[model samples]
Target: MSSPPVSAPPALEVTGLSHSFGRRKALDDVGFTIPQGRFTVLLGQNGAGKTTLFNLVTRLYSNRSGSIEIMGVDLRARPTVALAKLGVVFQLRTVDLDLSVKQNLLYHAGLHGLSRVQAQARIQAELDRLSLAERANDKVRQLSGGQVRRVEIARALLHKPRLLLLDEPTVGLDIGSRQTIVDHVRQLCATDGLGVLWATHLIDEVRADDAVILLHQGRVLAAGDGATLCAKAEVKDLGQAFTKLTEARAA
Candidate 1:
C-alpha cells in the first residue's frame, strides 16, 4: 500500500507576488521558497524590489496581487499565525540606545506576551548564544556596532520564531564583524533548525551551497542554489555569475 502524504512545510512561500505605487512597479511576479534548516539569500541591488518584498511578507505593505505563506500560514488570511512564526531584523538600527541589552530584549519579550519569568529565561538563553550574557546590563549605546547587531538578533529570536528575516544585516560593519554575524546565523540554521531569509546585495555573503533568489528591476531574475545559478550564468564564481545574469537581463 502507498504511504500517506507528509505535511512538511517550507519556512516561507511567496507566489505570484506583485506590488506597485501609482504605476511604478516595485515588484513583479516574485516567487520563491525558503526551506527549513537552511539559509536562503535574497540577492538584489538597490531599488531591486528586495525591501518591497520584505514589507509585503511582514505585512507592512499588504500584498494585493499575490500570496505570502509562512510555515503553511498565509499572511493575508492568517496574519497572526504567520507573523508569530516569523521574526524580522530590518537594516536600520532597532535597539534603543538608552536601554540596557537585557532591558531591550526583555521589552521585546514582553511585547511578544511572554511572562516575566519566561522572558528572563528566554532572554538569558538568547544572550548566551550571542555571547552577550556578561553584558546584558550594559546599555546598547555602550556596545559596539557588531554587539548591538547581535543583540537585535537575540531580540528577534526572543519570540521563538521559526523563520527569521533579516535585511542587509551586515551593513556598515567591519569585515570581522560581518563574518561573525554571518557565521552565527548559519549556525542557527544548523543547530536550531531555524530557517533564514537573508536579503543582501553583497555577493560575498552568499556561499556556494546557499539557495539564492536573484531580484532585478522588480522581478525575480533567477531562483535556485548558488551552484545552480552559477551554472545558469555559465560562470565559475557568484560575483561573476551575478554580473553576467544581470547584464543579460538589462540587454
Candidate 2:
C-alpha cells in the first residue's frame, strides 16, 4: 500500500489579533498563518503596526485579547516555552559593543539553557557559516556595522530555533550590507527549513515566490506570494501593486 501524505504544521499562526493604545488601534482583527519553511515578509508603511505585531509574536507586550501560536505552541498559554523555540533579531543592534563577538554569542546561548560546551560548538559553527570565524575574538566596537549585524544573526541561531523573526533587520545598513543580510536569510530559510518573518519596507528584498502580507492602516490589505499577488494586478513591482490595491479598495 502507498504511504499516506504528511501534513506540515504551520510555523506561525495568529487569530483575532487586535491591539490598541487609548483610541488608536495598532492592529485590528489581524489574522494570518505562515506555512513551515517559507521566507514570509510583512510589508507596511510607517505606523501600520508591523512592529506591534512583531512585539506580540515575541511576547514583548501581552496581548490583551487574541491568539498567537509559534511552532504550533500557543504563546499565551506557555509564553516561555513557546518563545524558546523561536529566534529573533530586532531592528536595533543589541550586541554588547565592549564584548567580543564570541562572548556575545555565548551569553545569548546561556540564556536559552545551552551548556557552555554545547553553546561553544554551536557558536563556532554559526561563526563559520557567517565567515566571521577569523574575527570571533574581535570586539563588536571594532567591527563594521555589517559585521556586527552578522554577530546578532549568529547569536539568534545559537539555540537552533525553528522560527526566525527579523524586524526591519537591514533598516539602516548600507546597500552592500543589506544585500548580504538578505542573501544570508534566504539561504538559511531554504536550507535549514527555518520559517522566517522578515518585516521591512523595501520591496526589492522580496523574492518572486516568497509569501507576503500587506498591512495598511492597521489592517491586512492583502496576503499571498508577492509576485503572485502583483501578477493579479498586472503590475511590475510591489510598490505600484500596493498603491493600486489600496487605492482601488478605497474607491
Candidate 3:
C-alpha cells in the first residue's frame, strides 16, 4: 500500500492583521504564513511598521482586528499555547550588562518556570551549540557586541521553540558581525529544521531562495521569495527591486 504524504503545519500564520495608535495606523491588513523549516525575511525600511508587527507577534500589543496562529494554535484563543511554540529576539539589546552571560539567561528561564536542572541543561546545550559555553561565567559587559547577540540567541532557543523571530537583530553590528550572525541563523534553519522569521531592512540579507515579505507604509507591498520579487519588479536583483517597491509606496 502506498503511504499518504503529510505536510508540517506553518510555523507562523497571520491573516488580516491590523493595528493603530489613535490616528496613526502602524500595521494595515498585514498577513503572511511562514512554513516550517524555512527562513522567511520580513523586509522593510525604517518606520515601515516592522517593529509594530513584531510587537503584535510577541503579544506586546493586542491584535484587535485579525488572527495569529503559531504552529496551528490561535494566539488570541490560546496565548500561552501559541507563545510556547514561539521564540523572539527584539531589536533592542536586552542582556543585563551587570549579570554573567548565564545569569541573564537563567533569569529568563526562571520566569518561564523551568526548573534548575532543566534550565541548566537547555542553557548548556544551546550555548554549546553556539560555541559559547566557555563564556557562560563571563559578565555580559565583557563580551563584544556580536558575542552578546549570540548569547541572546542562545537564550531564546533554550526552551526549544518551534519558530524563532528576530527583529533587526544586527542593527548596530559591524559588517563582519552582521554577516556572521545572518549566516549562523541560516545554518540553524538548514541544519536543524528550525523555522525563522527574520525582520530587517538590509537588502543584502535577502537570498534568492529565502521567502520574503516586503512591507511598506504599514502595508505589505509584496510577498514571495527574493527571486520572484525581483522578477516581478523587473529589476536586476533584490536591492533594486526593494528600492523600486518602496519608492512606489512612497509615491
lDDT of 3 by residue, 1-251 (tens): 12112466788998999999999999999999987778899999899999999999889997999999998899988999888888888899988999999999999898777899999999999889878899999999999999999998988887888899999999889998899889988887877667799999888888999999999989999999988999989997899999998898788
* Clashing residue pairs found in predicted model 1: none
Tens-digit lDDT track of model 2 for 59-88: 999898879998889999999889998999
Candidate 3 wrong stretches, greater than 4 Å: 1-6
Top candidate by lDDT: 1
Ranking by lDDT: 1, 3, 2
Q: What lDDT tens digits, residue by residue, belong to model 1 across residues 1-251?
A: 12212466888999999999999999998888888888999999899998989999989999998899999899999998899999999989988999999999888898888999999999999999899999999999999999999999999999989899999999999999999999999998888778899999999999999999999999999999999999999989999989999999999
Each model's lDDT comes to: 0.92, 0.87, 0.89
Residue pairs in candidate 3 whose N, alpha carbon or C atoms collide under 3 angstroms: none
TM-scores for the candidates: 0.96, 0.94, 0.95
Indicate whether candidate 1 or candidate 2 has the larger lDDT: 1
Cα lDDT over the full model 2: 0.87
